[model samples]
Every structure is written in C-alpha cells, then in structure tokens.
Target chain A: MRGQKDIFIVADNIVSPLGGTTAENFSRLVAGITGVRRQDRPEMADQPFYAALFGSMDGEDLLTEDAAASHAAGGGFTVFERLLASSVADALHQAPGIHPADDRTILIVCSTKGNTHLLDIDDHTPAERISLPGSAAVVARHFGFTQTPIVVSNACISGLLGMITGMRLLRSGLFDNAVVTGADVITKFILSGFGSFQALSPGHCRPFDRDRDGINLGEGAGTMVLSTRREYRHGLRLRGGAVSNDANHISGPSRTGRELGDAIEVALREAGCGAAGVGFISAHGTATAYNDEMEAKAITLAGLNAAPVNSLKGYYGHTLGAAGLIESIVTLASMREGIVVPSAGFETNGVSAPLNICRSLLRGPLDTCLKTASGFGGCNAAVVLSK
Target chain B: MEYITGSCVIDGEGGYKNEKKIFSFAAGSSQPAGYLPALYQHFNWQYPKFFKMDNLSRLGFAAAELLLEGWETGAYQPQEVAVVLSNANSSLDTDYRYTQTTKDIPSPSVFVYTLPNIVTGEICIRHRFKGENAFFLSTGFDPALLTRYVGYLLEAGIARACITGWVEWLGEGFKAALFLIERKETAGAVPFTAGNMDRIFKISMPCE
Candidate 1:
C-alpha cells in the first residue's frame, strides 16, 4: 500500500424512499422499512412490477420537485441533478472545511443513466437533455465547484467506484478532497432492459434466500465527501479498494466467482486486514440467482465466511449507482452505533457457499467492514472502510 | 517521472498511430451507418461483442487495440495495467437511441451502452485485464487533472501501466486520443509531464 492510503469519508447523505438524511435512512433500515413496492404506472405496461421509488409514485411530481428544490425553473435540469445537488449540499454543510471551489477539491459524479428521463422525448425536449456531462455540468455549476465535475457510469458499480476514485485521488495527491455522488431513477428505459434480461423479481426481492427469483429495481441518490487532510478527522477511513472485470461475460456474472474473489483478496491485502479483520460484509447482493450465488462463492473464496454479511437491496431495492454509496453510508452509521443491520430479505441457506448472513440487527462494534458491488459489463469492485 | 509510450487517434477522417496517418477512409466513405464496424473489419479484429457496443466503446476499444499493437507492456501483471479514460459527452449518442426505444419496449442491448465506462469494461474484457479502470466525463479535456491522476497511479505503485486519454462521440463524429502510460521511461518514450501533455493535446499530430 502507498504511504497515503487513509482517505476519510467525513460526511454523507442519502435521498431515498425511506428518508432524505442518512440518519433517517439508517433508523428506517433498523426498523426494517422497505422502499420497494409493486407499481402499475401507465409507462410500465399493464402488468405491475415491483420497484422502489421516492416521493409520490407520480413521475411528473418528482421531476417538478427536483426542479423546484434546485430553485431553477426548467433550464434543462434533471431529477438526478436535484438529488445530487441536495445530497452534496448536506455533506458540504455538515463536513466543514470542504471548499467546493478549491482546485484541490474535485466533484466526481457516478451514475448509470444521468438525465436519461429526457429520453422519453415527448417530441419537444431537446436530445441534448440526455447528456450526462451536461447534467454533471449543471450540478457542478449549481454548487459553484471550480473544477468541471467528472462522471463515472460503470453500471451498478458506479457508486462504489466513485468512492474508490475519491480515495485514489487523495492517495495520488492529485487532490486533497473529493465530492463523490451518484443516483439512478427507474425509467421505462432501465425497467425494460432488466426485464429483457429476466433479472427482475416479480415479488419482493429476497436476497440470499433459497426462494429468491430476481432483483427489484430502485431509485435514489447518495453523496460522500472524502479527504486526506487531518483536519477532516473522526470519520470512516476508506482504507483500501480494488476493481476487476469478470472477463467471463458481459451480461452474466462469472460462474466461478474467481475474479470477484481476486478483487476482494487484493482489497483485503491493500487494507492490511485479513479475512478475520472484517467485521461485516456489505455485499452487492442483487438477489438474482447468479449474483447471490457468485457473491457467496467469492466471499468464501476470500476466507471471509464467518464475517456477518448483509445486503441492503431489500431496504432500498438496489438503487443502481446509489446502491454502493447508500449501503456504505448506512454501514458506516452502523459502525458508529455499534450495530449490524440485517440482510433484509435473507432466509434459509440459498447459495452453495457458507455465509454468516445477519438475521437481525446484531449489536456489536464493527471496527472494519467490506463493501462489494458487481455490475453489468463484467465489472466487480470491493472497498474496505474502518472506524 | 514516466512516459506516454504510445498514442493513437481516431475520428471521422481516419486513424493515426503516434501522429502517422496509418489508416485512411476510402473516398466513398459515408457515415450514416456504423463507421466503427467498418474500422473493426479493416483491423481484422475477431471480437464479436465489438459489434454490440456503441460508437463510444468501439472508439475507445479500437484505439486501445491500436496503441497496444506496436507498443509492448511486457512483464507487467494483468491487474497492473489500468485504464483511465475521459470524454466530453458521456454516452449522449447512445442515450438518445435508448430514449427512442423507450416509446416502445426499450432494447436492453442498446441500454447497456448508455454508460461511459462500458468502454473501459470492453477494453478489460478483450485484454482479460482485471485491473483498476474509471471513466470521467468533462466539458472538455483537462490535461492537468488527467496527467496528475495518471502520475499518481504510477508513483503510488498502484499500476505499472495505464491506457489513458480522451474518447468522446457526439452528433455524427467521434474523437479518441489514447496514450499508453507506463512506469519506466525508456528510449523514445516522452516524459508524461503536465506541460508535455498540454503540448501534445493541442497539436495531436505525429511526433515526426
């Protein structure tokens, strides 16, 4: 590991179905509140599909709310831009000393589909509204960040990779601080895509359960401000992380789970923490048959079978790019509170490999934790966080 | 402290390797169709999935392939070869296409290419690289940020080599300028400093 590996996550926020603040979201998770539900929106076809959406199932309402929250009247701002702005606003306000305009600070946006809702067309909205860079530019300008923001769009791994990027920027000494944020809202574009893959569950997503069918789509935004400066003290230290491609399939996960395992092994090595050192494992746990099985194999291969594992998809319903950030922030909260959030929908041994899946909110001091995410396009990422 | 050992540029006009115009489009070239598939055929590359990726991924993939053709990242571990790519428009072309499908049942195939880093993932899959990779979107290329990040990767001992630079596809045209940055600055390898990067980025012509 480099001499500068400790990139501290000083502040974070989550805009989800449960609540807007990270504290509210954590409390809801502890109380076992799930954001996923079946919806029969006109755009989603006649059949109802289970998903997690935020504030008024009315799509138009969220868009207007997003624009209203930004205090801008239709200058081509997007729903995600609002979520990103507010979440970052909260983090910057709470974190203290995080100057968005400083050259040493860079805003990194992560998402799978930024402003994709503009794709709905309606025969009027300009095609340029779909530009991810343009959306990022709006968010950066709104926050008065001097540096033009950078976007990471690596499917579901985008959020986890965003945090990892922040840590690397600090570790590389390229920047002293990074504002990492990501969001993805369920739209006809994504819902149909996952449906085509047969990856969506018809019922509530039962992650790590024997009866698990598929995943429930979700929407939300999350933010994390990471810094290397000692003044940003007393936060979860992002110790080590690694990303790897399965190289086995684009749409499907590796059948052997070797590459994901390799990523975890390397991250563990980089963090100077062994399998036993990780007190909790916040897995990607999409609840699809393949992903859950693959994660099980990877976890066992990394010799972390005994680590208490949890998947937050049941609560937030797999917020795509926001999944990693929401999960990481909640886990950090759990660490501070000396509690372990349960794997919401897990029951009965589902996969072949042995796992210590949390059945309930386990009270324990979690000093070190691991966060992993796998996505389409054959990508897997693992990050280590410590108190 | 290191070097950009090899670089390749591609666009609507033709292809260049280190500023030498290596491939040129035929006189009758019309790009209402897939310019990328034609280039893939010209290169005689045998990856079928290349046909599925959008222009952005194809541009980055083909550019990386060209850079890796003459230059050698010999003896570097697979994971040690990282990728750091940036672009101005983050998959806007494909985003529009995916949106068109939204009126009907959105095609999952096209929807997957909506993310910019899918290009990095494509490169990784082709080379079997299980390494660190990221895709950054900016209003324009910023050499200072790019060079600093790449330099840190090499100096921090995180990556022995990296495929880094700009790849963006917008409207009817696309641009890709990829450089293979390595740890060891050997003969003929230009030192990858901020000043040199800005110079080459402006000129973008063959070093000759």
Candidate 2:
C-alpha cells in the first residue's frame, strides 16, 4: 500500500432504522432485523406497485439537541444530512482530542443526493441558496475547519470514494487526520427517478436470490475518522481501494463484468492480499436484477465464490451514496466483533453462482472484508478493510 | 503539479470543430437548440437520441468525448484515468422539469436525471474510467482548488491523468470546459493556474 498511513478508524458512527449508532446497527443486523417496510406516506399512495423502504427520519429532531442547532434552524437539510451530522458528532465525541481547526485535520463529505430534497420544499429561495457544498460548509464552519473541506458526490460509490479521497489527502501530508462522511436522504426525486428506470423493487429486496426483485430505497449517513499510518490504531485499516466503470452501458451493467472484477482484483492486489484473504464480501447487492447478477458474477470471477457474502441492504436498505461507507463500517464492526451479520432478508438461494450467502449471523475471527458498490452510470468501486 | 496539455471550447459560435474539440455552453447566452444542431452537424453523429439529452448530459458527454479523442487508446487505459467534474447548478434542468411535472403530472423519467453526479457516472461509463472519481459543486470556478484536487490524484498515483473541469447546465443552456492534465517533471509545461485561467478567459472572451 503506498506506505502505511498511520490512519486508524479512531471513531465511527451510523444512523439508520436498523439502529442509531454503529453498535446499535451492528446488533440489529446480527439479530436479523429487516428495516424494509411498505411505504405509508400519502404522497406515495398513488404508486401502489412501488413500495418505499426508508430509514427512520426521527434523527432530524435529534440534530436540534446536538451541536448543529444553529445550522439546522433554516431546516434546509433533509433527514439524511441530519443523520450525517449526528454521525459526525458521534465520531467527534468519541475522538475528543481531535480538533477541526488543527489544520492537520480535514473533513471529506460524500453523498449522491446531498439535500436534493430541498427542491421539494415550497420555498425556492432557500432551496436554491443551499447547495451541496453548503451542507459540508455548514459542518466545516460548525467544527471551525478553516481549510477547505472536500466534497464528493460520485453516485452510489460515493461513500467508498470519499474514504479513498481522505486517504490520498492524509497520505499526501495535506492533513494528519480527516473526517470522512457519507449521507443520502430519500426524496421524490430519487424515488421517482429510480422508479422511472424501473430499478426499484416492489417487494423486499432479495440480493443474490434467484427471485431477487429490486432495491428498496433507504437513506442514512456513515462517518469515520481516518489518519495516517502513524496515526493508525487497533480499530480497522483501509488496505486499498479501486473504482472502475463498465463504460459498456449507461444504465445497464456490463455483461462481461470485466471492469467490476478488475476493480476487485486491483483492490485486493493493492492491499497486498489475494482473493482468499477476503474473509467476507460486503456486496453492493442493491437486489436489483442487473446489480445482483453483475456483483455475484464479479465476486466469483475474483475467485471469492466460497467467501461468505452478505448485502446490508436488507438491514439499511440500499442507501445509495451512504451504502459504501455504511457497509464498510459494518465490515469493520463485523471484523472487530468477530461475527458476520446475515444478509437480513435472504430466504432462498438464487443466482447462478454458489455464493455462501450468510443467512444467519456467522461467528468470525474475520481479518479482512471487501466492500463493493455499483451505481446507475455503470460506476463500480471496491474497498478492502482489515482489522 | 501538471500542465493542461490541450484545451478547446465550443459554444453557439461554433468555436472548435476539429477531431477533438471541447464544447462550452453558457446558460441563457447559448441555447442548446441553436448550438447542438451545429454540434451534431460537425460531429456527424446521426443518432436522433443525441438531441433528447438534457443540457447537462449533452454538454458533459460532448466535452468528455472531445477530450477522450485526444488520448491514444493504448497510451492511457480507462482504468488509469479519472474524471473530477464540478458543477454550480446540480441538474437544475431536470429539477425544473420535475418541479413542473409535480405541479401538473409527476414524470419519473425527468426526476431520475436530477442528480449532478450522473454526468460523471455517464462520463465514466462512456470512457470506462473507474479510477478515483469525484463530482464537486462549487460556487464558481476556483482554479486553485481544481488544480489542488487534480494534483492530489496525480501525486497519490490514483490516476495517471485526470479529466477535470466545470459543467453547469441551467434551463436550455449550459457552460462546460475540460482539461486533460498530466503530471510534469519540470515547470516548463503550461500549468493550470489562476494566471493562465485568466489568460484563457481573455483569449476566449468576446472583444468589447
């Protein structure tokens, strides 16, 4: 790896219906709690065929109680941004000594739909005034970060991409410690958009299942503190990561699965590990037909057919931008806790590949896990994390 | 730091028409109806679907295609290159359409294209690039930040080269520019700095 950055996952946090913090979410996942549910919103009543699964938006009220009170006054951010702020606060609380004004520290925010929900509001002025950077800018100003915070919005792979960006900045000696955050809230825009493409699953998502329908939209945020190897500690180490696009299709996945497989192989090689080294695969199993099939094939092609695989989508639903970071956090938690949570809603063995789909929480002394994700534009990313 | 090897801008005026030409669309000033017809005529792209794309996707794809044409397929692999794009208005055209639809009839098709990063995603799929990609939304063009970001990707070995620029599409018009930047051993190459940016603007701007 480009010389070990002493980066340590000093602190991490997650906010989802599965549970609030990382520990809560991991516990619920181990307990096999499926957060997917039928849409109850009156707005979606007309769309009977489509069921909207989402994380609890209760966290929005919690932000007012937290430190981001002033920024939350205007109420421009969606539930996802509040969740992101909560995760950030949780991380900062855990790492009490780290200061944003230190200059040595940086903030990297990732999301696909950063406050796009603001567009749904009646007040066009507020919506137009508050841009994606405004969310990070508010967080930066709140934390007193004088340096420019880096923001990444690379569709579904945004979470993992943020981590990679943070690693680069930290390794380049641009900052000693960086706060990497990812958040994406559900909105009519995203829901209707995916619906238009017929990518959403009407029933519970069944990743890698033979009858896998499609992904249920979910929203949440994941945040972690990454430092150089000199700052590395006992939590988890981001070994290596790579992103690749199929470029074969705009909306559809590549049939060859060459790019996705190549990305996995490249990440593993960069991490100085082999396919066997990955104890489990945290797949981007959006449960969509094309995504699941493509991911399963890519995993098998990477020679990890025997590796226990699970999609956290059942737990948190397909959290678009936050999935990568959220899943990566879950992978690390699984490694540290010695248990691989089951793919929450899987009931049948599906797909052509014989994947060791974890139906029940599997005990582990798991050392390494591969976190993979793919997006609408044929973008795919794979990141390797180790304890 | 690296120098911006080649650059081109195409707007309503039909600026660049060579084998590899960068296309720029200024919101309000250059309408897609006017420029795209000429663009299609010049590129000889017969696909009627080209006209169907919104301003953001159209300008983004055109500029990216132009930049990609300059690189030899064998010289730079898709996996080795990355796209770092920024836009001020994040899919406002789709946003506007979706908003309008909501008032009358909500169309899912128009809603899906509202996200800004779709352009980068489209560019990635078009070029098959997967290396260290990111889409930033800035207040405007900040050459220092852009240069710093591109430099970060290059120095860290994330990508051998970067296709970086600003792409903002509002209503029927847009403005898009791209730079194919590669790291240089010496300072002699044309560095993409604020000074050079100012010079380029002066050269490209209409004479008063």
Candidate 3:
C-alpha cells in the first residue's frame, strides 16, 4: 500500500479457446467450463492429445475481420502477429486516453516462439522475417506505434517478464504507458518437442491433484494496457515484480524450491505488503508433477500457505507465453467481482507441503494478489498486483 | 555509475579478454564451424555438460567462462549477480536442427535448447547465479537498452553486478561478447556506457 503504486492497469484483453474477451473467459471459469479436449490432428501429433486450441483455422483465417483489413494492406501478418494485434486492439479500444501513435507510449511483445511455424512450409521464409524482432516490428507498425517495440522471448515466463520490463521502463520515465502482449500458436514444432519430453497430458490437466500427470498444451493471446493514469474501471495496479533463476537444470524444476521462493519474497517486499495482505495466488501450476509440487513448496516458504491458490491451466490448458497475462487478467477479474475462481481440475491434496488450493468457487473480497510463473532455462518470475 | 570489470569475446577470429588476444585458432583451420569445441578443448575445461549444449549455449558458456576466469571470489552474493542478454535470431539455430529431428523422433536434448534464454540458464547453473534473468530480442545488439536496464537494476539494489552482452548464432556464424559490470572500479575497468558497449561489441565481430 506504500511507495509508488502509480502503475495501474488501464485495460486488458484475452483471446483464448474459452472466449475472445476477459469477461467471457472469466465467466466460463466461474461456470466450471473447460476448453481442453482431445484432438486427432495427424499433422500436430501422431497420437490423440488434449489441448485448448483455436479450431480449424489456418493462416489469415485466424485473423479477425478488422485485423484482416490491416493484414491486406501489405505483407501478410502471421497467426502469431495477428493474435497480438487483435488482442492489443481490444485492450486499446477499452482504454480512454492511451494512444498507440503517441511517442510516450510503447509496445512490448512476449513469446517463447514467434513465426517459427514458417519452417513447416516448403518455401523457406527469409531469416529476418522469421525472427521474433521482425514480428514485433510488424505489429508495432500495424498499430502506428512511434517507439521501437521490445520483444521478450524468455521461456514460459515471457509474458510476466514482459510486464515487469514494461513496468520498470515506465517507472524510469522512459515511457508514459506500455501495451504488453503475448501469444503462441499450437504447432507441430511445439507439439513434437513437448511430446518428446512426454510433458503433455493425455486428458484434462489436474493441478495439485495426486493423480496429476502433465500439462495440456494451449494456444491463445493476451494483452494488458498499463499506464500511470487511473482512467479505467478496474483499479488493479502492479505494485511490485521480480525475476530469479534456480541455477539448476535447464529443463527441470529446482529441487528445493528456494529460487522461486526468493522471487516471491522479493516481489512482496518491493510491493510494501506483508504476507497477510495477499488475498490469493494465481499460480503457474502447469499440473506437471514437479512444477506443482515445487510451487507448493515455494508458497509455504514464502509464508503464504493460507492464501487460497488456483491455476487457470485447467481452463485454458497452459497457454505458454500467454499464460501469465491471461491468468493475471482473470485474477483481476476475480478481484473486481470479489470472487475466487475454483481450481478447475483439482481433486485432492497432492504436494507434500500443505496449500490452500481452492477447489470450489468462493465469494469474498480480494485486495491484493500474487501471480507466478516458471519455465525452461530455470527462470522464475513473480508479480504483486493490488487494488 | 557502474564499471565493466571484465569482458570476453569469441568468434571466428579467436578469443579476446579485456582487449587482449588470449586465444587464437591455428592457421588454415575450418573455423566458425569447429570454433566452440576447439576453444573448449583448448582451455582444457572439464565440464561434460558442455558437450550437450547447443551451439548458442556452448558459445555463451565458453565466453562466460573466459569472462569470469580468475574472478572466482566475486564481491556480490550469488543472487546479486544478474544475467541479461539479447540477440536477433534467438534459438532459431537450434529450432532448425530440432525440426530436422521432428521428421522422425524429436531429440529431447536439442528440443530443450530451443529457447534463447537457455544459455542464461546454463551459465547460471555453472556459476550458481540466482538473480534476475531476461533475454531480449532485437534486430541487433542494443547497448542503450542494456545500459539503461542494467543500470536501473544496479541502482534499485535488485542486483549488485550483472552479466550483460549479446550472444547470437545462426547457420555457420556465431558471436559472443559478454561483459561483467559492477559498482567497484578495478585497474582495467572502464565506465559502463552505451558507447563503450557498442565499441567493445564491434571489437568482437569479424572484419567485413
């Protein structure tokens, strides 16, 4: 509640299989609906797998009618770029004072993989056009952004890390506001990779459940407009944020959970809020055995064991780069409605450390919340959002 | 203000530390292709994990090893040293290789290194660094952004020291220019400025 809580969330949008807007997605979560289902796409994987994907759309068909108008202006916009543009447009439309053309504004794009799917085509895309920076530039130009766009490509934490980067830049007087967007498509590239690691679950993912197997891959996009002005309906503000590394195995979780725990502690300290002030936690519970168990341990180590925790993976099925922002937007929705959404796929206590996993809908006042994510490269990120 | 305590650049030409030529490839050698393993073997470093790394990680790991050599006892705690890196191609080098494997059974080892930040992970694991980690993507090395971001981290007390630079690899080309930044001034240390960074990065690149 103290220090500079000037960075407020002006507006946000989420385009997932569950819905095209945050309100639609949040309502579906509250009603106990899941977007994950088994698919038999021979192109994506040989075996049937569970995932929440934008169905039956390829190339320009994935773009909305409005976004397609801009796409037809010049070079084609890849599916990944289209998602970012569509989501950011909706977020910008909701905000009153934010302008993309203003020099004081900036755009930050986050994605673990952007336009890498072009490799699937026989015609080799030029190296520059296939890069994440190239996609970011295209989106920036489409929006008429006056400043250079910054692209963050960290593993799974890219979305949250992007927001943290945006927040820091604004606080440093580098920009008056920032539009942060993240998206990743479900492609054979990702499927075969995750399939090789045996990380994708066969059915709906169950977070914090004893029988939890693995994650259900998801595809979606999310955007949030953050500004120094409080000209929006939702007064949710990003109070503090921190990033850390486990220094452990590149592809595995930390054995002790101390790394993620450290990030949460530092983020809370920076927010000037005690553990008691946190209303709940929006966890990066991908439902993988190690990830959920490690997160449970980190929560207890951070002294927030009593705060009700939930993961949106069961609904959206772990949307890679978009998970952090989509989940945060849903968390803000929970705060606005004064209700805690249930952890959709949870059945029982699974982790060794005791966590207050919310298994059912709970209506209550929420003031502050913590969102966390961990990814490949042994990286972890945590952010404290307050009302 | 912070100072650049150490720096190491490795590319087709050879390896240089603090603007001094510390290692060079033999004449008529098939360079830029066998450069990373050659450097690793030349140093006689005994880390089996080095072989498992993709070219990007190997390039970064070797450069970092040279950058932090003889500085085992750093002034800051393990969590006080941050790793902030940037590049253009990202892990596309590995992405292309991994895609080849996807034609049959995908290789998990190669699949893991598809993300650009995995290099940071490997470096952190080797050095036990637990501080902030971020990997940015741009058309080229951006000294201004790194100077401003790393400076902010040091000023805000988020990190006491930082490992900032650019490591890029695609096809047959690779470049790793890493610098260690700290608040303390050493004998050969220089002021951490955008101009200095850009100049040092250029020094690391092969002549056109």
Candidate 4:
C-alpha cells in the first residue's frame, strides 16, 4: 500500500461537550472528563433506570439560524451536519492552502445516521426525511465541491472506511486532495432502537471493565484533510488500511478472531511494519459484553499484547459511525503530543489476555499507532498511521 | 474501469427463466416485482426448510449464487470473495417489524437483523467468505463511486473477485442486480462501461 500524500491534519476540531477542538477534547480526556449524563427527555423522565449519554456541543458556536434555515428550506440538516461543517471549516482553516471548491479536491463524508434526526419530524416522507444523499449534497454544496462526493454509511466503520475511500480516490488520480469527515448526532430513534436491542448501558460506559454492562450512545464529528504527498506536509501519514468481514455472525462477534486479526495483519504488512513497530492501539471498545472480548482476542491474535491500548468510550461514550474517525483523531493527537491517554473507567480487567490498558496518561515519543474498529454485520477495519 | 465479466438478475420468475425476458419498471413505485419469484426460487436451494426469509437475505443469497456459478471453488476460495453492496431504505421491513415487537416484547433475533449491513454478513456466512467487505448506503445509484470502490478492492488485492450491486427490498417491491468483477491484464470483453449498464438495464436477452 502507498503512504498517504503529504497531506497532514494541520488542524483538527470537535464539538463534543468535552470541548470544541483537539486540544480541548484531549485535555478533558486526559483529565478523565466524562460527558455522559442522565436522560432529560420528557418521555424518558419516568425511566430513571435508563440514562442517555450525549456529547453535547455548543450549537450557537457551530451553527447559525440562517444556515440552519437554508438547510431547513430542504427540511433542514440535522445537528450532525452542523457539527460536521464546523469541523470541516476548522480543518480547512488549519490547512490554509487547501480549498474545498478546488476541482482537484474531493469530499468524503461518513455517518451512520446522516440526517436521521429528520426522521423524527413528521412533515416529510421517509425518503425525504432520512435522505443521506441529500445530506451529502448539502455538504458538497457547502464546500463547493463540484466533483462527485462520496458518502459511506457503514455502521461503526463508516469513518475509517471513509478515510480509506479518500485515500483510494487520491491514489487513483480521481482527485489531488480529499476531505474526509464523520459525524452523527443522538436521536430518539437511535436511542429507542438500541434500547430495544438492550444494548445501552445503564450509566457511564466502562470499556473492558469486568463489570462492563453495555455501550452508552454519544454523538460528535471529526474531519481530516488529505492530499497527495506532493501537495501537503506536517500531517500524520496514513500508511495502510484493511477491511474484512467475520462471516460468522451479524450482531455477535467471531470468537476465533481469525477474520478480524487478518485485517490488522494485512494493514501492518501493507505498511511494511510488524506488530512490534506499533507503539499503541486505539481499540473499538464499545463497553459491550461481546465487542470488548472480541477486540481483546483480535489484539492478541495480532501479537500486540505488549503495545499499550485504550478505548475512548469512557471519554465520549460510543459515538457510533463517528467513533472511528473521532478516536483516530485522538490517536493522532496522542502521537503528536507524545502522550497516550488512559482507557478511562477501566478499573478491572475482565478478559483473559493481559492488555496494556493505559491506566493513566503515559508521556513519551511515539511513532506508529493502530486504530481498529468493529461494527454490526461482522464488519471490521484497521488502519495504521505513522507520525 | 473494471469489467462486469458476469451479470445476472432474478426477479419474480425463476433463475434465468424469466419468460417475459424483459424487466419491468412502473411509474408509481421504485420496485417492480417481476423478479421476486425467480429470486425466491433460486434462494429456495439453501432455505428450503424455513417458512419465510427476509428480503435482504433472499436477495443477497440469490445474487451471490448466480455470480458464483461454474466458478471453481478451490481457485476462488470463499475467503477470497467479497461482497460490496449499496441500498437506500436499509432493512426497513425488518426495522418496522422490530419496532412493532418493541411495543409488546422485543425479540432479540428480530432486532439483530435491523442494521443494513447484516445482509452482507449473511451473504458472507452463507458462502464462508472472509475477505474485505463493505456496504455503502446511498439514496440512489452512483456508478462512479461504485466503480471507484470496486477498483480499489481489486488493486488492494484484498479480494480476487467481488460481487457488487444494489439490493433494496421494501414493502412488496424489491430490486437486486449484481455483477461479478475480476481484474484483467489487457482490454477484454464485458467492459463495465455505461453501454454495458444500459444493456443490462434496458435491453433484453434471449433465453438459452
């Protein structure tokens, strides 16, 4: 596999309650900040047993009524779009030379619930209300990208896959530069949907904890600007990536970890690196009973037992489609800052393998890091990055 | 651009057995039920015992089976094949039923199939494929994105061959068309260009 273009994440931004940018979010994460809270909806008032976790963003700072009104004209974009736009703007501002409208640039957006908030409203048809294509068109129009914009809606792997798509587009000479973004907002449908599945944690999530119950749904957005190696510099290089299917179960994870491990191995081999070269691993620890165990197995299968690993679920809850990119930004930040944040809320080790769950912030110079995510449908993706 | 070496579609009629020979398109609806019986007939091979099958599974299984016909299993091991699909409504029928069950008592089995990518997983399990896989959900077809993604999969060497297409099954209507694509050394027959797409969608072929 080819290395990412000189494109660097010159700037990064986020809109979680933790803070609005990489610095603020990482600072809160290092300080062990937890953005989850109890449910506040009127209908959910009596359900004290259920708490809703959310990554609240500053709406006023992220969107304007006029902008929302423009989106509202087409029935309005969701909070997810607004947060995504803010992050995209921040990324572009950091990379001053890049322009969204450049013919050579491509925009790839990822979201499992792209304007799904519109689904809650009753004014439009199902096609119009939950229109992912329209939401993507809105983003593309905002960026003035005349080129065909690609939107990926894969479950949790959406962001990682979106990055991979952008990389492919650049390599194919389809575009010189690409902007990749992933965003999702909490909605009643998602909450009730997960609730119906009994997958929601009663309180704050405790990824990899012995008493880990389930995942706490959260929302946020992350954007990264990618260009050919000849066009940009100072960004973490995307070295290699792979995606695979367990082919074992849809909702459940494969116990053997064969398929998941193979994806990581392929990514490492493509990057011309070995397991030992990986400094740390950003795991998709969803605080669920099966996902954490399966991830531990996959890591062991990849022979990364000594590498320090952590899941940011405790910091941001499970961000669904945004988890891959959001956690990836966190991993990149850690690489830049020479510090690995601890896996917050991981008090007890439950799985058999002894994983190096960062109990506290570890400060050191790091180079290569692995970001792995697994989702519904047995979909798994792994990407390797170099500092 | 990749070439669609092999393409097939099964609707209400049986496999390669649509007497009408022409796929139907209606004004009021997105799905034309002309291929449902053919799709189900082909799918019945694996699911003979089950009283009913979900549309996603039924369509995925039928499409994949058609693509793999006459192909050597040893040469193209199940693990070397990948399924890349796109759809619009997601698993809406399943989602509707899943939501309805929540009003009384929810069934875990039904809830598991709510995610859109589950159909891809089901296909993989049925064929035992462990290769790179993805499911892109979009409102409508964008052949450009599909071509780019398929080319990426081939170039990455993640899968020797891939079954890619659009499968949307909502209400009484459903449409599924899949193409089996493999890399070529030089210009070959069955190029996956706009002409081929038009031929597959608009033209009719005589039965063998």
Specify the highest-TM-score model's number: 3
Higher-DockQ candidate among 1 and 3? 3
- Which candidate order results from sorting by TM-score in descending order? 3, 1, 2, 4
C-alpha local distance difference test of each model: 0.81, 0.73, 0.89, 0.73
Q: What lDDT tens digits, residue by residue, belong to model 3 across residues B34-144?
A: 877888788899999999999999999999999999885467788899999999999998999899998888999999999999999999999999999999999998999
Order of all candidates by DockQ, from best down to worst? 3, 1, 4, 2
Off by over 4 Å in 3: A1-5, A59-62, A230-234, B204-208
Which candidate comes out best when scored by DockQ? 3
Residue A9 accuracy (lDDT) in model 3: 92
lDDT of 3 by residue, A87-173 (tens): 888888898689989998999999988786787654377889889999999899888898889999999999999999998888777
**Predicted candidate 1 versus true structure: per-residue lDDT over B1-208, tens digit per residue:** 6897877887666787876778876645677236778888888998897878888888888888998885554577677888888887777788777767766776888877877777887887787777777777666777776887778778777788888898888778678888888867766678887676655554544566
Q: List DockQ, one per candidate, in order.
A: 0.60, 0.50, 0.77, 0.52
TM-score (C-alpha, index-matched) for candidate 1: 0.93
lDDT of 2 by residue, B1-208 (tens): 6777655454444344222334444556644656766676777765564565666777777767675664654667778887788876677667767767776656765665666767777677666676656777666666666776778777667688887877877754466667777865333347767666444433455677
Which lDDT tens digits does candidate 1 get at residues A1-387? 646557888798888878778898888888888988888787654579888887553333444343465565555456667777767877788877889889999999998877666565353565455567788888888777998777787778899988887887778777889999998877777787788677889989988999999999899888999999887677779888888877666678989888889889988888989998999999999999999999999999999989999998888898888898888998889899998888988889899996999998899788999999998878889999998
Q: After best superposition, candidate 3 residue A125: deviation in angstroms?
A: 1.5
Cα RMSD to the true fold for all candidates: 2.7, 3.4, 1.7, 4.0
